[model samples]
Target: MNRKLICYLLSSLLLLLNCNKVMSASWEITYPRTSSDSDKSTDYPLKVLALALEQTGVNFQLIPSEKHYTQGKNLSRLKDNREINVVWSMTDRQREKDLLPIRIPIYKGLIGWRLFLIREDMADRFKYIQKVDHLLKLSPIQGRDWPDTKILQANSFNVVTNINHSALGPMLSNAQGDFFPRSMLEIWDEIETLQTDNKLIIQDSLGLQYPAAMYFFVNNQNRPLAHLIRTGLEKAVANGKFDKLFNQTYQSYIDRTKLKKRKFYRLKNTFLPSETPLDRKELWFKPN
Candidate 1:
């Protein structure tokens, strides 16, 4: 064929293929695989995103972190590579500046509040920890690079960190830290996994309160995907689907924690980004 004719034919074939192809973006999502629940590959916000993505016609493949990496490492890997397109993390001024934040509080700020897990022998002492100063006298265990660790330290609680999530149990067990604070939703599964060590006990009467939230952080260049996910999430929240999912997933924990009855030692979160939607009270959960 002559060059002109060959070019014409190739262009026609390309046009035909384009007409038949479905519009889809293949998204790769990475989540930490907790030893407690394998099925919880996607936390509540990601769950909403998965549903939203389906409505938006994007194809997604969620893969658990093949190698265990901390949230800090997850954000680091969210850059450049297509392997990890989204990372779920709390919004701090620094993180929002570094990554494209979805700006939605995925769990309605429930994860921001904390319950304590101390060594069984220290449970009595923690119960008597009636003030912030008392808790500050001893260090708490936190996952290294976790936003909670920074928040804890910032709020004047001494925090000792472990890079390995699994090691927090041993650190607490060995008296490396006085307590490990966990969310009401997360404590049950984690404490059960660590119970065999016989060194930890859930504090009965007190809770730590803070204004915190978890949000999805996408690379700055990935704004298109961020918009897609954000639009979907907004729609979900507006139409009440998001609230339904939130309650279904976490109401039991709210009941279990008896959040209102517990003596909450409230602390301020100085690191919360100014752009955070704290005024959107409807977006946050309040104990009934």
Candidate 2:
């Protein structure tokens, strides 16, 4: 072959190899996972994440961390970019400072609309408690590292906390806490998955209302990934795919709550950051 032709062919081959490498490269996104068979809370958020990535037309792989960590540990790992690259969590002032938040409420604020899981025997006592003050006298079980624990404590609601997420149910059934305040989106699945034989019933008469946002957080330095995710999520929201998936996942549970019939006591979410998009009514769920 002529020298010029050989040089051209070699350059073409290198270009082809570089193109292949670019095509094969994908973002490796890691998220926390637990061994509990009943914990399906991550299902919807993970789906939303997948949807957002799809919208961005980005090549990415979603991975569950091999090591199970509590919510706090997962956030810490994400902040350090240690194992997990992304974490979905309730936003607080400090959390936003530690990580880049997408600022979209993945649960549409449903995470703050809480219902109580009380021992079946305590049903009558809860039924008569019409005032927030009366209910504040009862203790609620929460994860030690959960934002809800601090929110409850800030609101003067006695909170019993355990580091283990799975232990909260048993604590409620064992009377270690007077009641377990769970998100309406989570209570039904949790009740069905309760391994204990002790009867725990949803306290139907009253609910707690606060303004909270569950956001997808990435390492502070991962601005490109953060921007991509936010762009994809905004696209999903504008296209109505976000609300559709959200409804398909939690509509039945919302119906079961009959929130219209329940009187809700409003509490100030002191942890909620001032920058939360409270003006975006389209991004929140308001029970009629």
CA RMSD per model (angstroms): 5.3, 4.3
TM values, all candidates? 0.85, 0.91
Q: Write the per-residue lDDT of candidate 1 for residues 185-214, one digit (tens) a residue.
A: 888767766743556778878888899888
User: Given candidate 1, what's the lDDT at residue 120?
Assistant: 82
lDDT of 2 by residue, 1-288 (tens): 999999999999999998777546798899998666456777898999999998987689999999888888999999888989999999999999999999999999999999988899998898779799898889989999889889999999888999998898998888898988889998888888786657898888888989999999999999988988999999999999999999999999999999878998999999999999999999999877
Candidate 2 residue pairs in backbone clash: none
- Output the lDDT of residue 195, model 2: 69
